[model samples]
Target: MTVSIWQADGTQPVREVDFLVVGAGIAGCASALFASQAGRDVVVTDARDIALGASGRNAGFMITGLADYYHKGIEQFGHAAARELWALSIKTHDYWRAWAREAGGVHMDQRGSMLLAESLEEAKELELAARALNADGIEAIYHAADPLKRGYFAAVEQPWDGSVQPVELAQAVLRLSGAEFIANNEAYKVEQISAELVAVHTRKVIFHARYVMLCTNAYSFTLHPYFRGMVIPQRAQVMVTEPLPDSVIPVCGYSDYGYMYYRMTHDNRLLIGGGRHKFFEQEADTTDDRVTDGVQGYLDGYMRRFFPEVNARVDRRWAGTMGFSADGVPLVGTLPDSPRIGFAVGFTGHGLAFAAGTAERAVDHLLYGTHPGALWAGRLTR
Candidate 1:
């Protein structure tokens, strides 16, 4: 995102904005909505159009919490933090569901979701996770044996989790936010000039904004050096089978220790994604959204292994880049040096689970100096 020495040469127009949001993805749009609700005139700008990044390319499973099993999350991040994060995820889902009801046409199916186990050890983990969830008063069904009879060992089902048309939902959020959107606008530099104004230098214009929120996620490294090691971009590959006569699976299924996921689309197509873990070096730390044969081959094997009955042809193959935090959680905070430049990034492939609540907390933090609780970026330093 470098500007050439000769291109435009200080000719870019300077626009004064109230609350300028960089990145029009789901997080950015949600931030805009909350900012607008706070009576700030918000403008959202993106490197690409709205929802064209991982927000659009994801499998659209609305499963809650971090991308780890509940028990594992508690073990990794302690019990209190895990419960807070799970509650935040539910809050995010509540916002999306309310917005969907308001939009009137957004496609959202509350068919619930399942965390199936591909191995015996994972099945044991699933049992623990289900027990932990139940002990915490979270309603979840634990299956000791394969519930789908698809050769899986066990499952943890969340009856409140669901699936969605991600792009449509993002667009609906943008429309509801009523923020002015600028597409194909790449913000190269953001600096707090003086103590009151933040300057955002983009390809189209220079915005002197009162506040700025970077929802860039996977692209966060491109804008600031602080995110270079904090947010690693990993590529995600996906392929959807041609429509079948009927639904193959009634719920969104995540298995193989969260490395692979499959769901039945509204049109009756089987969509499967993941396998980058099989080729870590090739898949990690890059923003290249290109499907690789290595990962796609793994997905092919996965489909055949779990869904041997499907004989449909592959309809399309695509890729996306997910931002993985160094700590396996979303980050929400302002730059310490430039506190006016706030951010909500590093969803770790759980944007739907974390983004809405994170964005709300981010906007409130940036606007009112409130703290972002468990998701505080300062935790990475501590």
Candidate 2:
């Protein structure tokens, strides 16, 4: 699509682009990069700076597999579908590794991850997951013995999965994407100009493109009501503690079905997040990114319980909004009403794990008219 602006002196300035991506988070940045690499004229815009949202505020674990446990995923979607989703996550992890290498190896650390089992029942579940994963040729080990000093009964270790510095990764993606970026440009409205064009209006400028991809995630509902109930927003609180003398957490870890996750940073600071379940009612359907006392208290309690040896104080605390679908899966496809506009949101809190592959699939649908076989395709409209 082509956009023309009439200057005060009656001169016309025109800009044409093939794809316009909204939101500068991981999904949006990845979309822009893929489109540009495919020789498409792409433009990316964000209301805030890159990685200021959930993309930056997450626990930094580059995990493989679904947000839901593998056993639960098999129960919900069956084995074939669950396997596909797991495969997709592994592909995303490989993509990040390749991208990081190409971008001078920034923000990526290949330290494997473990899912802690707080109870015997949870350990059985982990054992079931490990079996299913190994059956599918994915390596997984169930550690019946406690590997860490924490009081977890058992753990499921995925040696292939790792962690990344989320903010640094986002910055590297934006810098290496080679797409025109307009930061601090908040898109207020999106209009389908025609079957072949979409228009995005920000406070300062109106962007026109042949195709528009919305990667807004949590803020999607604000831009369009179509995603209101389908893609609900939830606030996730995170806190980083003062650097300790020794590393307490050897590997990235999560427990309680990923409701709580923590990892020791390279600088020996414990960066922990999660606990929305404690304040589910207040956190659900809200875009507020402020850390609430209730959730913060829960996180603090978790830290004290898990790392009692470290007499560290919370150095920083913040919150970020994450979109969640009825199912844990993300929404990825074109909007039913507007085929020219595509979206990839509702990743729950697994954006970092799913963003790259999700963006690539969405772009494939947009560019080549291919059908996306996303596990949640049934939940999302065309």
Candidate 3:
């Protein structure tokens, strides 16, 4: 599986490996971990340092469901399909828990999570969702009473869901992966040279591998046209307030149907993220990672409205790009025309919940010819 790649100086530098994984995020790191564990020669390269992308800049929620609520998923994807999605979501959560435990268990907290409904209508929606979840043998209890005393009409608590320090988790996973990591090296292009070899061009050098896995997520579109329109890039803003006196947020939680999420860190900082719905048009199809005034303002207003008693100022703010498929499901397995190249992208805004799982599955498909079934990368129509 040796391939020759012409260097910028017109000389060919050939290096052969079993797997060359793009992006050092969670998915990339997980792929490297799985492949290396299976006795494969793996090298993972990233444009920036590990976990610098969305992998680090997320709300740190490790929930056990899709991006949408159970009821909403049923309405949009039908009952049977939605049930399967839920089952997979639970499996992803379990996988994450086990991995975190194996990585020393310091980066995760099993404090559980809740979905708060701010209005009576939203409360009904939570109730319906809880019913649907319980019917599928998952534990979901709906509470009409607001325990946080924030004037929420209702809430649903999933005892199994928890939170993880995303950055720490990613770093730990990278260390445990046992794969050669090349940081600050961005993969610019991937060319299939033969049936079993591919050339990956980066700024520093060209990597030749038997199998090339694309774990770049939102940035996948920049490397190839196959993902240009299929994987739409979206920018999400997030902020962390100064340390509060007590745990303002007792547990990880989401409101407004998982759009706005907040969690209390181990140091008692209120980490909140999500305003994409407020700036839907502005946030869509953009690779810009700059945090805008509009989205930040909305987040601040939301904090004030929800937690008026605590007036903690925002200490830090940033943005991260996420890839959203047309139907919001992640894409996994091999690409359309390039059989030697595989991809795991388009996780929407729920990368933490699905990235590692899908990356492992992609590696399985690439190495053993196993199909990803419903999550097949080529199944995305738009």
Candidate 4:
């Protein structure tokens, strides 16, 4: 079933524009804002509402670089290409610092992140990876967290990482006065009207535009058949605890890399998420965000095992769906030289950290006909 947090106001697109972007997630909102600023008439819409999918439902961690370490990225791509990707990811992160401020301070924290491992061998690999990332200018260090001495793992602390409320950040960006946001409306089809015009079909209306950008992330399967083999949907589970007493649990940081992450909210509630890969086949759809006993049981065990100091009950449980790509990187670019078809999707669950910058660059390519930062564009062009 589709999930909605914002009701659509009575606004329908009855006229033509320069651009129409589908999917109001981070990338869509970013594209809408940039395209509008570029003097292109722009309209942004989503299937349900803004920030309703992975945007609102993620755990909100912002660790630097891709899901893999520097060495792994090098292994996948060549050394020079990997280095450039690393530098660009870091640059995008720095750009995020300024973008957040422009979007009215989007709740970015610098509380750091810890990478834990269960075995000594895994710890050695992490240490080696940390060294390589450090050499590549990433500030990751091998430090065994005190929490892990109690059996979490030998860990590495990346000082530049932190968390945020992703949906709120996307909403703040959408508040830009120049962009038109259409909520509760889904894009049913895209038909080219002419060389300079295209039509975006919703359930009720067909909106016309000169350009169409697909920033729908995992939901792009309906529009792009290639995404089926490139990007696979993965569901992540999360739980938030009731606000504990101030001194009871000094809620400060976050843990886990691609799985098993938790952070303390401003209200003093502990929000934790992970454990979808544990039940791989069952989590590939955009269905119920409700938690299951198997996943919840693991989360409960994680709490008891790592955070035994604060024996708090789970106030609420929920799940969020994220797209995991085959090569573990986002795909952002035009649909093979089609002037009217631009797309930014397949984030593989870590798009929140760099989505705005990625979308901005993608829209720049759409507007200028070529991207200045060819490295970022090429990295995501897959």
Candidate 5:
């Protein structure tokens, strides 16, 4: 979100608004939606247009939990918090589905998703995760053997989770938000002019607003100094193959502890992503959204190792940045220096899994001072 001296020169037009939401991605648009619903005059502005960021570039799995398995999540954040995050994921999916129904033209396939295990040890973990989820009345099937017969060991099938058109869903939410949307506007800096007014200096305009929600996600570090180390950027590489004559993957498939994922797109093309863990040094702490040969080569090898039967040529390749929090969960709270400037960032590559619900809590916490449990930013300090 860098602005050159030649671009703005600090002469941008000044605009007044009730609530200003930065980053027109899922979290930002969802923030705008919730804030407007709460009777605030909200405006959403972005460096890029709606759905042009990570929200549009995802594989669109409406997975009903964090990036970790249920048992792993329990280990990381404790049982209660893990359950709450799962519930949040479900609630977020519900919001997206409702928006899909309301807006139309969005495709949602209800075939569900499978968490495949690449090794025997991972298979055992999958079984444990399935049992943990089932104990909590979360219906997940444990398959002892690889269902796809793609040389994987085992899997946990979440029958309720589904794939979606993420970009379409984002657009639908934006339209339903009813907030004025300004595109190609990058917020270079933000300052609290007073207790009641926050000045958001952007490339195209400066906003004087009572409240501002920074849903900037991966690019959060650039807007304010406070975001440094709070939200780290991780780049994700993805590829889609030409439409196959037959579907290679029936459900959204994840394997290698989520280091690799493949899903059948709506048009019958196979979309593959991940491979970042192998090239961690290159992928971490970078906002550059360029496809790397190392990761893309990894995806190529992955496709060959698992789905060698698919001979269709790769049609497209691209990359996007994901915001990883200090903890792997989202960060929801207002800035200590400026309480009126709130934020919900750090989805940890689970933006589709957490954005809507996190945004909902962020809005509630910002406008009503309600505590956003599990993802409270105060926990980072403690």
Candidate 6:
């Protein structure tokens, strides 16, 4: 199963490694980093060029907590579990920051997330949600009117959430760890070659290893068919405005529970994302990166509606696909019967903050047979 990827140049043979990881996104890189840290010979490869998937195309919003809001998380997963998840999210953010520092630091933007309500009723709901979260020891502030703006938009602020350059962060992790990265390589199927080893067959080469980790989010089905309905791939589009005027848009802001989001980068560029839900059926498919004019129109309309003063024009527009699970929480840890295989996917659009930590903890469990205690402990297949 040799596949060709653009910009991928290299020739290698069927080789053996202590650990083999698929997908070059953050999860795969983090897994390789952990395995190498354990003094294990590791090989990490991906179908496309490194960081060319959701990891590279993501909005890079470094949010705190799970995919669900902190307040909603408590109701969905209970107070104790939600708090535990929040703690782990903070820890993961710290881990990424440390990794960035070691690798010359990431494009770090400490700007917080602003949640704007589209209507007054939604504003009240947001206020209640913020109060609930604060009562549960989380930091969230509610505003009756968007203080950052002049008009009637109500909003809430989460001081902990921030943003980063997705591709730069992944590249930094790979460089700092010095892991063997085989880009433009595709692993179609993984077969268990032995009790403690698996074989990953690509088009040009075969990689045999003691363990194989699937970190390819939406494309997980290509390797593990069982993940079909369990992990759905949804397409998302993002557009970046050419550097804007100094004081045009705020650093970060989102509307409708993060469905439509826009932020002004440090360089004064407006980065906006989210329009998949508009074309739900088309967006949910596993294949397809084509951007529809309808979706783009909606995004443009959203920009105009929010930033009426600034006539921002998009300098770059791209599409990314993310994994969404049934429960909204990430599927971390190992598979039920296959201890030699571990994965951390189904991030549900919450990959940036937790993917690194999930991979580290997953590899620890795989190599050491010890389990971690957090919201992700028993949430996976195991």
* Model 6: per-residue Cα lDDT over 134-202, one tens digit each: 887677888888877745368878887788888888998877667788877788767776788777777
What tens-digit string does per-residue lDDT give for candidate 2 at 1-382?
1122421222323346689999999989888888887788888888887888889887788888778778788899888878878878878888777877888747678788889987888888888888878777778888996788589988989877778888878777766788888887677778888878887776556667899899999888788888877788888898999988888877889888788999888787998888988778998888778988999999889988988877888899999888887678877777666778888787888887788888888888777767767544445453
The 0-to-1 C-alpha lDDT of every candidate, in the order given, reads 0.92, 0.81, 0.82, 0.70, 0.90, 0.77
What ranking of all candidate models by lDDT puts the best one first? 1, 5, 3, 2, 6, 4
RMSD of 4: 4.1
Worst 10 residues of 1 by lDDT: 1-10
Evaluated at residue 352, the lDDT of candidate 6 is: 82
| Residue 279, model 2: Cα distance from true site in angstroms | 1.9
Off by over 4 Å in 5: none
Each prediction's TM-score versus the true structure: 0.98, 0.93, 0.94, 0.88, 0.98, 0.92
Cα TM-score of candidate 3: 0.94
As for lDDT, the candidate ahead, 4 or 5, is: 5
Q: Candidate 6's C-alpha lDDT?
A: 0.77
lDDT against true structure, model 1: 0.92
Residues 1-382 of candidate 1 have per-residue lDDT tens digits of: 5666565466699999999999988999899999999999999999889999999999898998888889999999999999999999999999999998998778899999889998999999989989999999999999998889999999999999998999999999999999999998788888999688999998889999999999999999889998988898988999999999988899999998889999998888999999988899999888888899999999999999889999989999999989999998999999878889999999999999989999999999999999999989999876
Pick by TM-score: 4 or 5, better one: 5
- Candidate with maximal lDDT: 1
- Give the poorly placed runs of model 4, Cα more than 4 Å off: 1-14, 144-148, 247-257, 285-288, 371-382
On lDDT, who's better, 3 or 4? 3
Model 6 residue pairs with clashes: 1-202, 1-203, 2-203
**Cα lDDT tens digits for candidate 3, 64-87:** 767888989889878887876676
Q: Is candidate 4 or candidate 6 better by lDDT?
A: 6
Error of 6 at 218 (Å): 0.7
Instruction: Order the candidate numbers by TM-score, best to worst.
Output: 1, 5, 3, 2, 6, 4
Model 5: per-residue lDDT, tens digit, 196-304? 8999999999899999999999889888877799899999999999999988778899998888888999999999999999999999998888999999999999998
After superposition, candidate 2 runs with Cα above 4 Å error: 1-15, 375-378
